[model samples]
Target: MSTKELINNIDSFVSTDVWSPLDPYKDEKIIFQKGDGAYIWDINGKRYVDFINGKGSILLGHNDSDINQLLIESISNKSSTVTGPHQYIVALSEIILRDLKRDHYKIAYFSTGTEAVKASVNMVRMASKKSIILSSGYHGWDPLWYHDNGPHELNKNDILDVFFVPDLLKRAITNNKGNIAAFVISPDYVYLSEKTYNELFSICREHEIYIICDDVKQGYRYRSGNSLEMVGERADLYVFAKGLSNGNRLSCVVGPEQVMEFSRDFTYTSYYELLPYISALGTLKKMRNQNGYMQIRNIGATFLNNLREILKNSPIDMNVNGNGNLFQFVFPNDEIEEKFYRLCLLNGLLFFNGDNQCPNLAITNEVYDFVLKVITQVIEQLSSNYNTGSFSINDERRFISAWRQMDGASDFIDTSDRLIIINKLFSE
Candidate 1:
């Protein structure tokens, strides 16, 4: 069947169209066929350079030969999935602990980052015997942690929200006082500083509140281990997923003996799955051997620097935020941002519009050069249309709202203090 027919069939049965909500093209959606490295092809045989990278889960890139081989071998050996615990789980845990330098921490397996975050939140609450959870950054879509109009009514008393700003965080802590059980922070290196992190850590530590580092999205992308280690501070518990298994269904919560012991009360059948464990083992081993983390960082840094250089003399007042591995474009307004997004899609460049772009290790030099060329062209077009007063906002093509809803971009608190810091760091 054709792409249109397939989409029609899907629309007939699928209750929600989750994938194409942010796709600017309202007429037709691009149905992806296959992906290898930093590129994906639609069913129509059109190719696009994919910067989304499975929403930052494709660490080593899509269809990695080594990871594929490992899965095949495991399945052929009759060891892919079993009814009980397996050796791969133990081995992967050892490697994870050693890499994180947290030898005292134990691991609990889960299928998704959301599951891991939920498990971590429950563990912290149970261990502390406190109901309040002061949280910052995205922690999955579970109703227990996520609510569109703020904390859900049931969880309002349980989850209090805060921003990365030190003063804001301090106020939340003071307001909640001894009621706060733990401060769950999902670090965004782009919006926060090491000094701020240390301050937050100290504040929570002083009040005897447990710290749960929700490193689900920014975990392996930023560094080899979790974001906690990169900031020179440790958390009471760490939640890791996304790139953990390089696009496979795997997530894990790791913490010390006392904190992790609470996990015994939370168990599920699929937690014993062995395929994801094997995938994690292979992905981790390959990353270490090839220095994949550093390579990714370098690629992202180089791309950002080059893009900045290209945009330096442009007419548009645009800025890029975050580090090499993860960054986003801060357009002057919604119209310009949507224009850029539409142009990029037209040019066969898939960026995470209105969200962060996660560059992976599989992006070759050729891919980088091609992406830069497309971006340069897109910028030039945007500049001409914007400067010539020909830029008109398409009312029917609105995508920022959908993007914000899909990725929770609007959920973040972008304080003026944080903006000043980001501007200073990325200033030309």
Candidate 2:
């Protein structure tokens, strides 16, 4: 179906406050019909490699046979929720506690990452008896952290103290003093030096402020010896989602007894749901039995190292950042990024301009080799056309002919400011 007709029969074309629809190649939207392993087929049956992986949720890949089998069993057995506790939930909680090596921490269930984050903040507030929460990194869609995204201007929630920058965190802590509740953080995408990490932790500890480690996106991927691990010391509370059920809709907040007891008074979805619990249990088992987390970590490391090698001698002024499991390229200009995406899409590859490349277990050596080949071709083509004065970004044939003199003029454009910004944001 046409994009217009598809949206016309469903929802309006207007973008929501929190999310704008992704712009496919040539501004045309695509609706995917099916997926298997690391590939997805569009409605027209055209296949493309899927590196997005459902925003990093499907670590095991699309339509994973093992997970699907479990799901089917649950459905056929008529296993469902009844608004009461389930024995499987207790088992799932135990699995999380054991895997995280947090024997003293309690787990509270939620249906989504945002809900878990909100719950984590509330828990810190209740335990600390403080109103302000110092935060860094994106913490999901809710009035608490994300109001809007306008680069120079983002609408922050007015109800709470949620600071975006590290400097602002220090200032807020000073302004609030003892009124600071927690210092929430996500370390997956954001690059903070060891000095910054230590400084932030020390400041929080000095003021007796609670620490909430938002691990929704990085939990399972950073596991060591069957336990989830991060770069720094453990926090008082940890919010987990996304990688837990490998795309299943389940999230959680885990913390110590004193802080988690507040969950009794907090209204949340009951943990009696059977399907998500089954998914969680099965996913955790797969990870543990196959040592899937470690495997994934190794896979990511391999990809990153290989990517660095591939781009090392290239003329493209780009740098990769983020942890081994999640990384992105820092480009010099949005137009360059847009062109890169278009090129990859036309060549049976998918590339999003969001600056994150999340790999899944489906990224085998063969799959990665194909990806590298495509990337090499894209980069080579770009480099060849850089100073040739033969390429035109515009699609209008008449305009392109008229503006032939402008070709390669873009090469003279200075992008020093953009490079400076990238370095400032990611080099720390």
Candidate 3:
């Protein structure tokens, strides 16, 4: 069937119009058929560079040969699932522990980052004997961590929200003292500073509240280990997913034995699935052998630097946020952001518009250059339209409206100066 027909059929039965927050463009959605490396093909056989990268879950990029082979082997061996623990799980656990450099820390498996986060929160609550959790950044879709305006009604008193400001965090801690169980942080290193994280960690430590580092999105991209190690701080619990098994369904919550022992009470049937274990093992081994993390970091750095330089001279007033491997474009107005999104889509570049652009290991220098070229063209076209006084004020507002309704839309503000200064100090 054609793309439109398939979409129509999906609309007939699918409960929602879009699957995830990353899928914002409902009216102009591209029905992707297949992906290889950094690119994906639509039902019409058109190719586009995929910067979304499975919403940052694809560590080695789509259809990685080693990961594919390992998956095939596991399936052929009829070891994809078993009644009990298996060798693949043990091997993968060993590698994870070694990378963490903390042998005493225990791990509990889950199928998604959301589940891992939920498990971590539950463990912390049980261990600390407190119900209140002060959180920052996006944790997951679970109602326990959702904002006050989330789709479902929230308890309002359970999970309190705070920004990166030290004073704000301190006040929240002071007000909720003794009742606070844990401070859950899903660090967005782009806007967050190591100093701030250290201060927050120190506060949580002082109050004896467990620190749960929700590294679901940022994990495995910056380095092989957890974000705590990278930032020179530690957490009582760590949640990892996304890039765990490239694109396979796997997530893990790791912590000291004292806290992780609570996970046994929350057993899941599919937690011990064998294919994801094998996939994670292969992905981690390949990443270490090839030094893939450094390469991804370098690629991201180059792309961000070059893009920043290009944007500096453009007539458009777009701001760029994030590090080398993961970043985003912040537009001054919704109209221009919408225009840029549609233009890039029209020109065979699929950026995670209104969110992050997750560059993968498969995005080589050449691919990045092509992506930059397309972005430049899009910017130039946008500038030309504005210069000629032909820019559309009547452009459809649905996409931008949907994006604003999402949780991270608060980041759309112009904080270029603060972000640049923080990033500069961070690099040094």
**lDDT per model, in order?**
0.75, 0.67, 0.76
Question: Considering summed lDDT, which 10 consecutive residues are worst modelled in model 2?
Answer: 402-411
lDDT score at residue 118, model 1, on the 0-100 scale = 85
Query: What would the C-alpha RMSD of candidate 1 be, to one decimal place?
Result: 5.5
Query: lDDT of candidate 1 vs native?
Result: 0.75
The backbone clash count of each candidate, in order, is 0, 0, 2
lDDT of 3 by residue, 1-428 (tens): 87778888887879864545435466676777899999989889999998888889988989998889988887888776656788887888887777787758988888899888988988888887888887776777777764554321224648876545455568878887788888888876665557778888888888888888888888887888786677798887888998688988999999999889888877678767788888888888888898988899888789889999998888887767767677777776767887888888888888776777888888898998998899999999989888524333221222233233223212333334333433443355
Off by over 4 Å in 1: 147-157, 388-428
Model 2 backbone overlap count: 0
TM-score for each prediction?
A: 0.88, 0.82, 0.88
lDDT, candidate 1, 186-280, per-residue tens:
87666556777898899888888899998898887766678777778998888899978988999989998888999986767777787788788
Stretches of candidate 3 above 4 Å error?
Answer: 17-24, 149-157, 387-428
lDDT of 3 at 310: 94
Kindly list the per-residue Cα lDDT of model 2 for residues 1-428, writing each as its tens digit: 67568655444755662122246453555667898888888877888888777777887888889989988987898877657787888898888787667667788899888889889888878787877666665677676664343222223542332322344456666766777778877653234345555666777787788888777777776573221234356677888888888788889998899999999866445557777788878887887788776677686677778888877777775555554567666555556667777788878787545446667777777887787789889888877767523433332322222112111101111234322332343334
Worst 10 residues of 1 by lDDT: 402-411
